[model samples]
Target: MRALIALGGNAMTGPDGSAAPEAQDVAVAAAMEHVADLVAAGVDVVLTHGNGPQVGNLLVKNELAASVVPPVPLDWCGAQTQATIGFLIMDSLERALAVRGVRRQVATVVTRTRVDSEDPGFSRPSKPIGRYLPENEAKVLVEHGESWERRGDKGWRRVVASPEPLEILDAPAIIELAKAGYVVVGAGGGGVPVVRDADGTLRGVEAVVDKDLAAT
Candidate 1:
């Protein structure tokens, strides 16, 4: 049987809510122990993971370095986490499989999801992201045209529209990889949200997608 595992963003964080890279790698290594067992049982496994915290952290880093370097866009942050988490999974899975005497190929696909440009979610911007900020910082972001929402007890955070995912641009690659008996990781953070222009070309938007929906 074929199986697909959806790893939540929390899976990459520490038990105490820390998201440091070392903590995340430790978390992923633990998760892979379970995954290797599944593969050893003869189940074909594919993985999808969340990057909400990772992307938010990346955005925070971008903000801190803004004076000396340009800040990265939100969609780009998603892409960064995709590569980071994917690499982590690939390396760990390879080692886990090796230790279990299981041989399998691994690959990471940069995934994209299509959302209508006219989706009402875009106008509303309700999905919370990035680091929480104080009133002054949040106000500064709001004044600069970013969407910020005040949490009831958690200060304020940047928000973005989360439109429904209509299509996966990399489904073909994922299927082919899985069918070839290779474990694949893709659709990180539900894929970097994108919109196709009238010319049928794709362009990324500033949003993080839910990885569960992306995996489905």
Candidate 2:
């Protein structure tokens, strides 16, 4: 049997909500223990993961360095986190398989998902991201025409549009890899949202896609 495991961003964060690189490595290693067990039991595995914390961190860096460097767009942020987290998973999983004497190849795909240009989610902008900010800082961002919303009682956070994922552009490659007995990791952060232009060229968009839907 084949299984697609969908890991949330929390999987890569410490219990105290820390997303430090070492913390993420430990978290991913723990998670891969179970995946290795599944593989040992003869299950083909495909992995997809969320990037909320990771991408949020990237956005914070972008904002802090905006004066000295061009800020990466949302789609690029997704792509970056996909690769970063994918590497963590691949490394940890490989070690786990090695210990268990399970011979398997692992790979990560830089995936892209197509979304409708007219998706209403683009206008609403409701997906919360980044570290929560105090009311004063939130106000500053709002004043600068950025969307901020209160998430429970933690604080305010930046919200971006979460468009629906219509298609995963790398689905074919992912399936082929999985069928060839390789453990495949793909579709991180909903595959880096993109839309087709009038001439059928694809371009990245400044929006996030729901990872759960994209994995399905």
Candidate 3:
């Protein structure tokens, strides 16, 4: 049987509520133990992950460093985090497979997901992102055209329109990879949401997608 495992950032959370690299490694290693057992039982695995927290922190870093360097766009930021985290997951899983005497090729695909251009979310950004900010800071950003929303007792956070995923642009490739007995990792950060322009060319949008919802 084939399996698609959707991993979340919380899966890598440390005891102190942080998801540092070391923490992620430990967490992934533990997950690998379970996955290895499944592989031994003859299940082909396809792993997709959500890097919301990591990508949010990355955006915050870029924003904080804007004065010293130009801030990267959200699409680029998403791609960067996917590559970074995908590598860690692929490598860790590969090592686990190796220790279990299973030989499998692991690949990370830079995937894109299509969303409707007219998605209502565009007009009303509600997807929380980046780090939490003080109410005053959030107010300033919102006043300057950024979107912010309250997070219960925590401060507000920047939000972007999270549209529904229309299609996985790389689904065929992912399926082929899984059929070939390779562990494929893709769809990180909701697959770098994009839309085809009138010219039939693809361009990324300034929004994120829900990984779990998109995965379906």
lDDT values, one for every candidate: 0.86, 0.88, 0.81
Q: Write the candidate numbers in order of decreasing lDDT.
A: 2, 1, 3
Q: Which stretches of candidate 3 lie over 4 Å from their true place?
A: 134-156
Which run of 10 residues does model 3 get worst, by summed lDDT?
137-146
Once superposed on the true structure, which residue ranges of model 1 sit more than 4 Å away at CA?
A: 139-145, 150-155
Candidate 2's C-alpha runs over 4 A off are 132-157
- Compared with the true structure, model 2 gives a TM-score of 0.89
* TM-scores for the candidates: 0.92, 0.89, 0.88
What TM-score would you give candidate 1 relative to the actual structure?
Answer: 0.92
Q: RMSD for all candidates, in order, please.
A: 1.8, 2.7, 2.5
Q: How many clashes in candidate 3?
A: 0
Candidate 3 accuracy as lDDT: 0.81
lDDT per residue as tens, model 3, 7-40: 8877766667576778877887788778777877
Which candidate tops lDDT?
2
Worst 10 residues of 1 by lDDT: 62-71
Better of 2 and 3 by TM-score: 2
